[model samples]
Target: MCGRFIDANLRGSDSELSHIKIDPFERRFNIKPTEDVLILAKQSLEPMIARWWLIPSWHKGGLKDFKLTTFNARIEDAREKPTFRAAWHHGRCLIPAGGYYEWTGERSQKQPHFISSAGNEETLWFAGLASRWQELLTCTILTRSANETVNDVHTRMPVILNAEERDAWLGGSDDLTMGAGALLRHHPVRPFGISDHGPDLIEPED
Candidate 1:
């Protein structure tokens, strides 16, 4: 699961959602669940804030009901999962992220790896699902089986969306879902994950 990620854009100036003006955000190298984040929905290019964890509208419980993990919805099961089906079909969204973190090795020897776009882009847009609960907007990132490059580190990775695929994903058409599958493949730029942190965190480590 994508439990941690980096929100490198502290200034809204570098935002991909430039169509709509956004306020500056706190830069976070290690973002956790339930944090408020900015997102772009299919309904509009405007930027909106949403809690990272999704709470389905049908849920009867209060915030305490958030115990069920709804942060990462597996792409394969999203359509079938009751918790995600509604949002999957009607609440599709784009989540901006610098990169995400994953761990490798046995529990005692586990090491952290940072995954980002293969290109020099500052932010990676993720395919996401969002829903409204008690006037609050919440979302979850979608994940698929890992591509070859990141398969060694973990068997799963978030579905990273590219420019061309963005419109199709936000299009909300069933046929586009089929096309979106092709984009699910690993990025072409050789390296997938780096093992260290620092200014070069997004770069592949030797």
Candidate 2:
């Protein structure tokens, strides 16, 4: 589950996300759930800002009313879960992230790690689900079993999509064959929890 991540320039790229230009997306090294996020939803040529948590369209209560952890939806059960089902079937979207954070070891001495693409691709597109509640737009990142690069620090990682998979995902294709392998890299970083968001936080610790 990606509870926190980094939202930065990521060296720029000409991939599918090159067209996504979100204003005031100022670099953030410590983005957390419930905060505003950048997402490219289906049927839209431009990206939009959305509450980083998924709020079901059927919800009529206040935002604080629903607290079932909708920020990160598990890919395995999202298709059936009430909070994400509708969005999963039709509101699929894309979220771009420079990298994400994961913790390992004992609760008190947990070590944080920053994980990003192993290749030259700087922008990593995350398969997400978007929803509309009242006058607000909300979204949630999808998570799948961790691959070789992330399993050591966590059991799950966000559903990462390469350039080629963008069309299929936004076109409402759940048959996303994530392929037999994943290309990713991880390195230890200083622990900052939800406090510091400085760029230096991503620097390798050791």
Candidate 3:
């Protein structure tokens, strides 16, 4: 599950996210669940801010009603799960991030691992689902079983989308359903240890 991530582009001039105004976003290194996040949803050319934890529109109670984790939805079960099914079909989105955080080791000895792309790609797009609870918009990242590069750390990872995949996702077409699964495979990731927020966080700890 993707519990935390780094969003370096929140303040930068990202052409893909240019539609978003500058004043609302702040540079963030340790983004957590239930916090406000930037997302590019279907059919919209502009970026929008939404809660990181998705709250389905059908939910009648307050935002605190459901205690179950809605921050990350398993791709395999999203279509069947009541909380995510509606959003999965009609509310797909792209979550931009510099990298994501995961952990490994026994419960008492777990070590934090920072996961990012292997090369110059500054921003990684994570496939996500979004919903509206009253006037508040919220979203959830999609997760898949981990691939070779990250399987040693965890059994699951976020479903990452490339430029082409992002186009299909934002296009709101039937092709999205077919192409979504293919993008679920992990890319070559650069994993390093990070104890806190800093430039050195991306570097391997020796």
Candidate 4:
């Protein structure tokens, strides 16, 4: 599952880009779950903002109230899951980041690695879905079975969306399957580091 990530090179000032604003936090190398990160979604024709983790409206209580495992939704089962189906159809979103983290192996022997664009684009947007669980709002990143590139690192990767598909993903249309394969590009072993300002953290290379 995608529990951590990086969003270092955001172009908040770029008018062509969507809802992202200039974040005060310095580029992060280790972004954990429940932490507020930038998401690009739409409210009508205009882009809007949303937090990373998704909280279902049926949930009761605060941050301490729910389990932390809802951060990601499997692409194959998301449409059938109660927590994600509504958002999958009506509240689709885009999570903007430099890269994401994944892990491999048992607790003591787990490894970390990072994945990013081949060209090092300013930002990468993962397809996401969001919902408003009472007063609290939340989101979940979509994950697919690993491709050739990601197979070496982990068994799954987030559903990444390219610039052209960004508009459709955030448009909240019934066609949730559009651009599923075309928009995504994958990289298995790219440059990574332990520092906070460089690449995203995945399981350590074993």
The best candidate by TM-score is 2
Q: Which stretches of candidate 1 lie over 4 Å from their true place?
A: 8-16, 175-206
Using lDDT as the measure, which candidate wins? 2
Model 4 C-alpha lDDT versus the unseen true structure? 0.65
lDDT of 2 by residue, 1-206 (tens): 89888884633665554565555567898999999988877756457888999999999888789867889988888888989999998788888888888988898998999888887677778889999999999999998888887788888888887666777777777664551145788899987757786889989996
Candidate 2 segments exceeding 4 Å error: 8-20, 43-45
Model 3 C-alpha lDDT per residue in residues 77-114, reported as the tens digit of each score:
88779999889788888888888878776777666777
TM-scores for candidates 1 onward, in order: 0.81, 0.92, 0.82, 0.75
Candidate 2 lands at a TM-score of: 0.92
> What lDDT does model 1 reach?
0.73
- In model 4, the worst 10-residue window by lDDT is 182-191
> Looking at model 2, which ten-residue stretch has the lowest summed lDDT?
173-182
lDDT values for all models: 0.73, 0.81, 0.74, 0.65
Please report the TM-score between candidate 4 and the true structure.
Answer: 0.75
| Clash number by candidate, in order | 0, 0, 0, 14
Off by over 4 Å in 4: 12-21, 43-51, 119-122, 173-206
lDDT of 4 at 58: 72
Q: What is the lDDT of residue 1 in candidate 1?
A: 67
